[model samples]
Target chain A: MPTITVDGRRLEVPEGSTLLQALDELGLLMNGVDVPHYCWHPKLSVDGSCRLCQVEIEGVPKLQIACDTPVADGMVVHTTSERVQRAREGVMELLLVNHPLDCPICDQAGECKLQDYAVDYGLDHARTREPRRPGRKRVELGPTIVFDEERCILCRRCVRFCREVPETGELVVENRGDRSRITTFPGTPLDNPYSMNVADVCPVGALTTRDFRFKVRVWDLDEVPGLCTGCSKGCNVHVGVARGAVQRYTPRRNDQVNETWICDEGRLSYREIGAPDRITRPAVRDAEGRMQPVSIARAIERAAERIRAAVLREGPAVVAALASPHATNEDLTELRRLLDGIGTATSGAAVVEGEPDGLLLQAERAGNARGARDLGFGDPGLVFEKIRGGGVRVLLVMGRDLLAEPFLGGTDPLASLDAVILLDTHRSALEQVADVVIPGRMLAEKGGSMTNHAGLVQRVPAALEPAFDAHAEGAVLARLRAALELVLPARSEGAA
Target chain B: MVSTLVAQAPEATVLSDELRAAIDREIARFPEPRGALLAALRLVQDELGCIAPPTARAVAEIFGLHPAEVLEVLSFYNLFHTEPQGRHEVRVCTNLACSLRGARTLLRELEEHLGIRAGQTTPDGRVTLGHEECLGACGYAPMLRIGDRYHEELDGPAARALVDGLP
Candidate 1:
């Protein structure tokens, strides 16, 4: 470690750390200097073309770009110095000279680094009489990215990103001077599994995602730390919410998992948030075979009464629960207690097989398959077969509609069951057929910890309030346990 | 204001035996494979007449680099044409010394004779003409380069003779 003094504060940074990283570590990087960077993404290789991170080192002859300058022992650096400020102003002035000034229509207006730095360092108006440089706008660089050349500052952040990460190298700086723009390979779409990360690496308004470009303004979003539940990788994410729905999911920096990057598959999974088929209210089948909406309390009480009657008639062997591999640890634990309380140890989470992508995506698609395994659950496929063989008469489903699986799809898996209790976030094929369908909160509307396939537990906070009359799956399970114990005098609370 | 790239990818190209051997020789000279990219690309351009996307892919395959990486280098330099190079390349200097000595007029005359403008290939595909900023023969004002040879101390007639002299 080398000791360096930045802006009058002395601190020891790790050896081989750059001045910018050292300043960032010391917390001395602030004030009118603003962000003072464009091309230096923490994850990508540094291309110091922006020249805005200029700092006045005491021994250096010229203002050195902080991102490219290595820190030395006893080196004194000044980031808020007059020379550094003037350099930043000059850089900002030159950067804005050829800008289209279309911030009003730009999707990156609010959160753009160019916009942020321009506020503190830019001139009131352009000084040059020459017209703004003519460059192409709305260039579809690839299937996922839209390129606006004029907005680019020749920073090469996105170019470096494609070259380094994903190792695709699809994007390149075409031409030279003012005509330079990010161009893809002669003919290839930017559909690499992680191509959307380029838009996240771009600090300016140049590259914007086709999916989120005009859908929602960034400032309107309420960010909550969450995880991508598409797989057991548990890549941490910032769940962007607006109008009570998930607007987008951007990668959150979790070095243990996804390092400031998420796969395009997980990024676009936000589109499934408020699908039309989502279950909004709990429903119970009427005598006429129609699913009629019922109060949540009434639905739970009716569910308990039906289960008690089945337990008293067919004994505990007639009942088995199908647990969700996607549920949180708290919910899985509660589900375990509920299944045990009923004296039926028969349970299994349905297992689906797929090859792992060797990146953030894992072989296990469920977010908490490891949690389910650790909490003591079995194969849900076996539970369905048991129901078909007349061993189990009643089935309680957590989220997966195992009865709808192909093996049981032809014949009604619910035919042998006297009652079916389904708690699901989305409407399924078995919804109308199930005896009771309880509306459950979506993963984005529930808060708990989930252990990934690697057993790394991460907190998944609710970004939006539970939609309609839904409850957290854990809350429903706890209430169901309370309801079941009321009749089973032999089974007291916490006795299971 | 919408744009999109094709979902389909361009096919990769295979390198010729001699070009592959030359590329290996170039790669051996440098510590890293990428260091030989420029030399390898020039060799490919020489062999294939131009470093088009296919040839670029071929060179990239040899250098273990992305095709776009090779294409970017080709795009940055004015000499590495991406299109099939004409049988002959005619370049007239349009720098300060050359332009002052009637180089622009000579270039226009040549364009008219060749039936094409600077930076364009003739319809017959016999010659490609362009103006350079400097050809490094400033003493011979308004000097023009034809292939590897420089035609210097020239006027309209001699320049025409030199251009017509292309076999």
Candidate 2:
């Protein structure tokens, strides 16, 4: 272990650790003691080209880059000295020489590091009156990202990320000196699954997400901790919500899961959560056999009445419930308890399978399929057979649509059921045939815990209220359980 | 407002057998195949006059490396040219020491004699003129390196005579 003092506070770090790592271990990086930097990402390799992490050592005459300099025993460092401050201000001036002042319309303005440091380091005004060199304004790098050449400071964080982490090596720094810019080869576009992560790593407003461009500003939105429901990988993310709708999903740091990088599919999957075609209110079958909007209390009463009548006519074996792997553990647990109370414990979970890219994505597209299995849900293959064989007359669908899967051969299973009750956030193919449709909250609006494929339990909090009159699956299930107790007092008493 | 440099198509292979064998021999000298990229690129440029995008792509494919990585290395160093080369390339030293010794005047004289700017080649495809920061030849002040040979202590008339003498 080597002991080094940062501004008179001494600490010991593991041998061969750089000074930047020591500052991070001492909790002086990006908080408490601020060292301005652009190219020094903890997850990426050391690129000392930015020259912003310069710090003055006790004995060394020149300022050393804290990212590349290894800590020595009995070394004294001063990061806030007058010399260090002057060096950082000089570097900031050079970086801003070619960078544009389009912060008002730039999507990364609010959360951009260069904007924050410009205000922090007192370089908010330009010293040179020379006209800034102009370059390309908006270059579509790929399907997910857009590149702005004029606003780039050329820190090369995105280039390093492609070459180091994902190792795709598609992005490169072309031209030399003042004409240098980040670009891909002519034919090879930046089409990797992890390409959008470059937007997150950019310190300036150079690279921005195409989906989130001009949608909403970061200051107006509230970032709430959430998980991406795209797959069983359970990548941690921050849901940016504004005005009761989700705007975007950005990755959060979780070394055990995604490690500060999320796939482009997971980031864009929030579109389904805030899509305009979502089922916003509960609906029930009316006199003309059309689904009409109804109050929550009325919808639950009608569903309970039909379920109890089916149980009385054909035994509990005819009534079955199908749970979705997308639901949280608490939601699935409540659904299982309700089905057991009604004497139809033949319920299983729905699983969607695809090819895993061997990176962040998993083959099982459901977020909580493992959670469903842990709660003793039956296999999806067996449940599909029970529905097709007509063994189940009355069915409760929780957060899944059976008609959406191609294994059913384009057949609508809800057409054969006597009464079909559905609980989903989005409008599905089975909506026309369902006897009762109840709008439920998506993953961004849920307040519960979900177990990932590795059995790691993480909390997913509600960022905003449900889109319309919708409620969480757990909340709706609890309300339905209360409504059923009144209709079937004898069966409820035995289960209780 | 977007601009991109055209990379050569990966499907094209423009290297001859002799050049490919030379590249393979250089690559076999190092434990890591990528360590011989500079030498392999030099071999291609020496035989083909310049390392075009297609030639770089072929070399990258032979070494099992990404073409972009090879292009990055090609564009980074000033020694390697990624475009078609002139029959004769002239680089004039223009650092502080050489400039003080009247190297800039010599460069201007050579550009005027060749009927082209510093970075442009002649219309007759005879000579290309370029200015370099330093060639580590301060002892040989007012120096110009033509094709691999350096001419020292040159005046305006001498610099013109040197370019006019090139066939």
Candidate 3:
């Protein structure tokens, strides 16, 4: 470890650590005194392009860029010195010369680094009397990203992010001097798996997500640490919510998993939260065979009564449960308990996912396949085969539609079954066939943790009240378990 | 999401046989191939006289760089051209020393004679006229460099004579 004294305090940071990383470890960033920067991101390479991070190192004639400077033992650095302040002022002035000064209309106004640093250390008046350089106001860089040329400070954080992280060198700084702007190849667009991360890395309003452009201000968003349920990777994210709905999902830094970057698919999965067809009320097939809405208590009671009738008619072996990999571990635990209480066999959870890109996107769709298995969910093929073989009559689907599964030999798998009790978060084809349809909650409606494919358990806090805030899947399972225990005495050895 | 959209892959390289051999030699010189991007770009410019989009992609294939990076560096230097320009490019030194003498007046005369502005090529595409910051020949004021050679100590008649001589 090398010891360095900065602005007065002395701290020993790990060896081979850059001065910026060392200083950040000292807890000086956004603390009492801050070293303003634009291009120097924690996860990216040290680019000394942005000279605003210059600090006065003792015995060095010129101010050194702290980002590229290695922290040596007994080094004395002054960030608040007169020389450092003047350097920052000069750099900020030159950077603001061609700037469009559109913070009033810019979406990145409140959280923008340029806006923050200008107020802290920049000069109010611009010395240049020349006209500001005009540029394209709304340049569509890709399907998801929008580029504003005038607002760009040429920090190159987004460019480096594309180069270093995803290794997709699509974004490049075109031209030089005042004419420089970030662009992709002539025909190729910035449509990489981790492309939206550029919007987060961009220090200015130059790069913004097309999905979030002019939608909701940053301050208006109520952010909470959450995990993305788009895949089994369970990428840690900050759920940005407004008006009781998820506005966006920004990846939060987790050294173990997603390092401050999320896949575009996972980031866009927040759109499904407020999408139509979300189940808001419990429903049951009435005497006329039409699904009718009912209260949560009535739905659970009716579902339990149907399950009991099936167990009474034949036995517990007649029923089979298919768990959803998308459900949280907490809900899986309750489902497992409820199935154990009913003494029925489980067909296991469906894998239903796309091919893995070998990066963050896992093949098991969404969250908690490993946890479902840990709770002893068997193979789904067995359930499908059993349902196809006409050996099973009463079917219990938890948070998934297994009838539509190809493995279930989709010859009306519900036709042979007498009753189908489904716990779903959305109105699906299963609703038309299921005898009892109890409403379940989405990832955003409940607080729970799920084990990722890597076995790292990440807790996700509910960011918004779901469109249907009726009952969580766990509560529904708990009620069903209680109702089953009250009626059946844990049917033994397939006894009728 | 954005990743779901299809991105057009770059076409097969259109680098010439001789240019490919030259780029390979340039790549062998550097410890890493990407380090020869600048040198490879220079060779492309010398061979093609300009770095067009397709030529840039060809060079990028050799250097393993994004074509946009080559375009980024291509725009930084005045020596390298990206688009098809005049047959003979003329740069009039209008720095402090050249302007103090008579470089601006000489440039105006040449523009009038050629019927084109300082930064534009003639209608016939014979010559491109532009003003440079400094040619490092400040000692010899009022100088204009055309093609590969520099003509120093020039007046309005001398500059016009040189332009008129260009066929």
Candidate 4:
């Protein structure tokens, strides 16, 4: 352990801890100690660009970047020295020399790092008398990225990311001196799975997402830390919502899973949450073939009674439980307990499979298959085999969209079962075969915890009210346990 | 207005020797001749003061690219002018950092002085004023680009003088 003093406060940190780590440990005590930085996100690898985190060391002659320099035992760091402040201002000035002034229309206006650091350390008056050398302006690098050459500070963060993180060499700086600008080689477009992250890493408005350009301001957005439901990888994301609608999704740092980048498919999947076809209410088939809305309690009671009747008449061996890998561990645990109480041990888990590229999108389409396993559902293949064996008379399906899965042997396994009960948020082929369908809320509409593939539990909070009379899967399963007279242990509330 | 007339007339069959020389030099610098499309277009824009579709097509033909490709690059990059403009171009950097320091105010001043909004040339065709996002010059809050030069730390008076001084 090394003890370091940051602004006169002594703290012991792990040996080789960066000045940033020590500052992080000090917490609120060092609030006024300003540090300017960009391309040095806490979640991402140290870039040391922007030179904004320049700090004065007790003995060092030159200023050091706090983000890159590790702390030494008995070391003293000063973040608010005049020399360091002047250095940051000078760096910001040089960065702004060639940068275009297009903030009124730039998408990154509110949340851009350049804007924040400039306000903190940049000189009030620019000394440069010569007109800025006109650089490449709006250059459409690819389908998703629009590059503003004048806005680029040559930080190389986007280039480094394309090469290091996603390992896609799409962006490269061309020319030199005043003419240098970030560009693709002639006709090569910046097309990659993790291409959108370049826009996220750009400190200035140089790299802008074509999909999000001019759509919404960053300040107006309210971010909800959640997981991407596009695939089973469950990349951590911060869903930016504004005016009761999801505006955009950005990757949140989860070292155990996505690191600092998420795939474009996951980034754009917020549109699906706002899809027009989402089911909002609990509907049951009434007399004369008319579907009527029922109360949540009534729906639970009717579903429990039907399951109990089937179990009593056909025995527990005939009752089968079908769980979706999209559900959280709490929901799966409660559902499994409720079914197990009735003596039904044969449970099946359904997971949708997609194209696996070994990055971003895995073959598994469900985001919470690992959570399902943690709740004792076991392998999905076993569930498929049990359903095919013809021992199951009643099937209770939760959250799985069987139609979306082409390799599920064409939904014949579901058709063979008697009295299929579907509990899902969307309309799928499995729901059509289901004798009773219960509309459930989407992940964003409910509060629950999903244990990602890395086994790290991440909590998702409800950003808005349920679209209709929908309820959280955990809440629904809890009510079902009450209806079936199954006593289960309660899970803790709040996000992990 | 006279510059627009000259631009429209297609006066001489011969390209300006200076313009031809600049394009030739840029084309010679590239390993693949077509790689000089952006550079050549910028050179032509500098010589003729605007990039007409025909001139852009001519540049594209020299580079073995489609005229649309050349046009796309011109439209995509903010520098090359697609339309005839005043003798000088005034582009204000409006990226995030500059915006926070009141680049919008500088833009308003230029617009008021030029009597035209961004992306439009003055009625007399003496200057083309435009607003660009970030020019990566965060330290120089409220900066504007005039011709091949950058004027930083600009207020209303400073921005107006820079625009007014444009040839």
Query: Model 2 segments beyond 4 Å from truth?
Result: A1-3, A10-12, A25-28, A56-62, A72-75, A124-134, A404-407, A489-496, B1-9, B96-114, B136-143, B152-161
Clash pairs detected, candidate 2: none
In order of TM-score, best first, we have: 3, 1, 2, 4
lDDT tens per residue, model 2, A14-67: 699898877776667877667889998878888899999999999999999999
RMSD of each: 3.7, 3.9, 2.9, 13.3
Candidate 3 chain B has its poorest 10 consecutive residues by lDDT at B1-10
How much lDDT does each candidate structure score? 0.81, 0.84, 0.83, 0.74
Tens-place lDDT digits, model 4, residues A239-330: 88887788889998776788778888889988877777776666665655455677777777767767777766776677777787887777
Q: Candidate 1, DockQ to 2 decimals?
A: 0.37
Looking at candidate 4, what is the lDDT of residue A234? Answer: 82
The DockQ for candidate 3, computed on C-alphas, is 0.42
Which tens-of-lDDT digit does each residue in A92-134 have in candidate 3?
9988989999988999988899998899788888888999999
Q: Pick the candidate with the highest DockQ.
A: 3
- Cα lDDT for residue B67, candidate 1: 77
Between prediction 3 and prediction 4, which has the larger DockQ? Answer: 3
Better by DockQ, candidate 4 or 2: 2
Candidate 1 chain A minimal-lDDT segment of 10 residues = A401-410
lDDT value, residue A437 of candidate 4: 70
Task: At residue A14, give the lDDT of candidate 1.
Answer: 72
Point to the candidate with the largest lDDT.
2
Q: Any idea what lDDT model 3 has?
A: 0.83
Per-residue C-alpha lDDT of model 2 across residues B92-158, encoded as one tens digit per residue: 9999889999998888888878889998999888898999888888988889889999988888888
